[model samples]
Target: MEAESRTFADAEVNRSLTPEDKIRFLRDMYRIRRFEQTALKAYNAGKMGGFLHLYTGQEAVAVATLSLLGPHDHIVTAYRDHGHALAVGMGMNECMAEFFGKATGCSKGKGGSMHLFAVEKRYWGGHGIVAGQTPLGLGIAYALKYKGIPGCCLCFLGDGAVNQGVYHESLNLASLFSLPVIYIIENNGYSMGTSLARSSAFRQLLAQRAEGYNICWDQASGENIYEVRAKTQAAMERAREESRPTVLEIATYRYYGHSVADANARKYRTPEEIEHYKTYHDPLLLWQKRLVDEGLLTGEQAEAIDLGARAEADAAMKFADESPFPTEADICADVYSEVDEPAGDAPRGTHFFN
Candidate 1:
């Protein structure tokens, strides 16, 4: 197919990726993979509370894309966001602590797995509600435009969120106001357990909808980290420099259930599909293959990277286990933004709370 060839040509492995860069990419992706593996262990052991959504299969999308952002940029995504948070530079100890509901968490142990927020990191974090982060990302883009900042907002959502009303509404307004934002749909085959085929009425590529609002559109194979990085770079340029809005649909897959609990992924899709993906379609494995084929890495070196990640995650687990949990009286404390008053007569938090 000519179209397929063209897409491949666009992603022809970047010559600029130094040996160090290649090593780093492998390291980061492996880190997330190991982190999730450890988190699953903790979840089963009852160390982590609330629902756990593992970004097990989607590590490449988060790491490759966030590597393109700068300090001024902003980003938000859906609930399956632990990988995204770390990709944006959130520390491993805090992330694991957050998973364990420790007070040292990025969300101060309150947000749990689905809601990890770190303003200092420029990561707005994962929202629990479907399609909820769309308008919020748009608002962040609006603020960047208003402040005359050189930043863009990358809003990551699932295939399911595209069908929601707020998705369309924000897309329309972003195009109208020329918000510097790129809306990325991580089309991981299913919306929870439901396949995209059942829910999506759009017969063609989801990016086709962009034409109606005068926005640019693109697609990348989310299964390939290099392709994701290349395509996202072009879209990021159009948004950050030209003040254009774009919609990018990436075809990725989730390895685990929708949340950790959706053990019936096999009911919707065959076990063969899962096995094939892990063998050939996995982003990490695929990249490892590429690196070896190109003589950028040895099989032994690749295994070492995996071992390092697992060891690092084990250390972070110790940190989380030692961290403190929030107290009963601390419930209403962190609701809104305010510095702790200097031993004033008035109560601690806000006008309403104080």
Candidate 2:
């Protein structure tokens, strides 16, 4: 079956979500959409630095999946992470400030664009390297299990990252130890410029590979928030209760290229293909229509929510514009632990070479 033809009608709605919760989901999704739009605008106008991976078309995946997290649950994802960051409750001001390379960023301006991090929020990072965070995610789950924490970790990676050797290694370890981690492959159909079929060796679904490692696997549509939540919540429960790992592949898409740097985005894929996804499978439009259908929201309310999100994004951009840069003196500030500092107690030697 085609990726676009995936059925969402049969997916059950999460009944626990109140009318207010459903409205908040719409608002949160709109917030991510507007933020990505603002970031694209800034990048196109040369106001932002570094590679900008706009999460324009995959808002539902992040918003719905992260919504299931408990206080002890954690998350980590790849560089195309703006949507995930916002869904996890990171402020737009700090995220936008990171895009502007200002000191107020989550990484304090040291890690721009692809390295958004907030340990306090249990959002580990926005790792730049492909598949690099898999091991880290595995380790986090292992630690949680070791400490007897009743939580799990959601480790997200793109289709491109799944081919990396490190990811497979992480998979093996997760199953062997019964670690509570969910490996979500956000298969956007393309890896950089290469399409998934051409890049990876997969028979049916990518997540099916979990069978080899004796791990649970499932696939769902990223276009529907209800489906996303229903599928992910099951995996989270499995992890939390049984301490088992899962591999979930959500069929999603990206409107932009792999990054703003890829000029051949439109060339690689037909314009019609992009138009179809935008028209039929757009998460924001679909969710808005669903809420309206359920009598939980009206068209006017949805429009107002979008307008509010846009306004918030614009304000964040303005704040980023005014925020200070990291000073020269800040270079070595976060590099070393207090015990590793020159005047500290640790007997350190040959730590730095310059």
Candidate 3:
């Protein structure tokens, strides 16, 4: 028999979650919304640079999924990663600094918005190229298994990358060796102005793609944090204990265009679609409303949380504005790891041209 469909009402009634969990979930989702809104304003004002991909309507997907990992585990994602970085415990000031191109940023002003790295946080780093992180994720899982470490690697990619050769190869290798890695395909419906329907010939669900490689399949609404958290917990348990790899596809939508540069998402899809999502299926608003209805949070309390988030976002922009730009000497120092490397050389030091 086919499995039953799970709705938001089902998650609300069936999932086991605490009051504390709900509170944190709502707060974090609101925070992400606030941050993204602030970043858009900064981008418009030219305070922050680079291609900005706002994670406007997909906050819950990143927050709930990444929360499953402990400090020892690893995470890697695509360019739409500021939300993931925040959910994994990177401070707002540093994240904003990175977008500001300040030396104090997470990647030390080198990676910018597209490529963010926080190795200490075990976030691995975000990639700019489509499906580029797949091989890197497989390598990380292989290393973890080789070292006999018990931690899993959580690799995230957009629907656009799922069709790439590296993703399939990574799945084959991961499942073949029982590598402990959970791959999350955030399907926001559009692959840079083209809908998934246009790109892929197969109209079947994405999870079924896992069957070819023997990887287990899981699916959930990216808008539902509770469902996402519950499903991610099960996947993490299987990965940690059984040394298995699972493919999770999250059905989600991005309110903005492919990047901040794409104004109002008018190039490909209609503005009506964006307005519909904003009115009905907004991830942050859905969770907040649910929390209020469940009596876990009062409307006033939720409003307070939103105000607090707005304040924090404002502080982050200010922090980014005040942070100093990367100096010339700093850039020259980290240019090449070894003097023999193809990229240039240091003038006096072994690695630097100075």
Candidate 4:
């Protein structure tokens, strides 16, 4: 028999969450929103370098999903990863500094915008290549299972990445080895400049293709944090308890272009369509409204939270500005394992230019 559908009511009625917890979620989401806004401002002013893939509208997905991670759980994602980085507890200063290519960045000014990493926090770096993180996520899961740790690796990819051959290979290996991995396809309708209908070959939900690999699959609206938590929790449990893999597709949207470089972002889609999502389907607004309706939050308090987030973002940008850049000798560092010191004269490579 077909399983029953999960209904996510307007309020989502999550009684397990304390009032404080709910408010914190709201704050976290706003922090991401504000951080993205600040990054965009900096990018426009030519203060930062590299391709910045902003996480403006999809805050709820990263915030909610990452909030569910346990001690053993790990996460990896694509270039649009600022929200996930923040959600996983990386400081705004370090993240913003990474964009500015400062020495204080999470990757120490070496990895720039698309390569935020916090291994200590169990968050693998965001890969710039499409579907590149999929196999790495599988490797993490395989290690977890091999080590007898009841953990799962949350691998996030965009809709565009679903077409990659390596992604399917990773899925096959995940199912074959029963790796505890949850592949989250953040289906934001348009992959780069192409719409989902124009690019993908799907009979129904994109996640339904999981059936071919004999893995459990599901899709849900990414607008609601509660809904995201509910569905992700189920997949987490399956991974922990059964050591099974799942393919979860979260229907999300990005307000900015594919990257900061995509000039045709607004041209591909009509302004009215973007306005509709912004006005009605904005995750932050929807969550705030729900909290207010439940008497858990006041309108003034929400406004204050938003202001606080903006201030925090501004402060982070300032920190990034004041921080120093990596030294010239630090170029060949982190390339080879034997190169112990970052300021070492040279590595074992004969092709070293310096």
Question: Which regions of candidate 2 fall more than 4 Å away from where they truly are?
Answer: 1-13, 339-354
All candidates' TM-scores?
A: 0.93, 0.94, 0.91, 0.94
Name the candidate, 2 or 3, with the larger TM-score value: 2
For candidate 2, the TM-score is 0.94
The list of candidate 4 runs beyond 4 A from truth reads 1-13, 341-353
lDDT (tens digit, per residue) of candidate 2 on 117-177: 8888899999999999999999999999999999999999999998999999999999999
RMSD for each model, in Å, please? 2.7, 2.8, 3.8, 3.2
Cα lDDT, all candidates: 0.86, 0.90, 0.84, 0.90
- RMSD (Cα, Å) of model 3: 3.8
lDDT of 3 by residue, 71-127 (tens): 668999999998898888888888888988988888888888878788888988889
Residue 72 shift from truth in candidate 4, angstroms: 0.6
Compare candidates 1 and 3 on TM-score and give the better one: 1
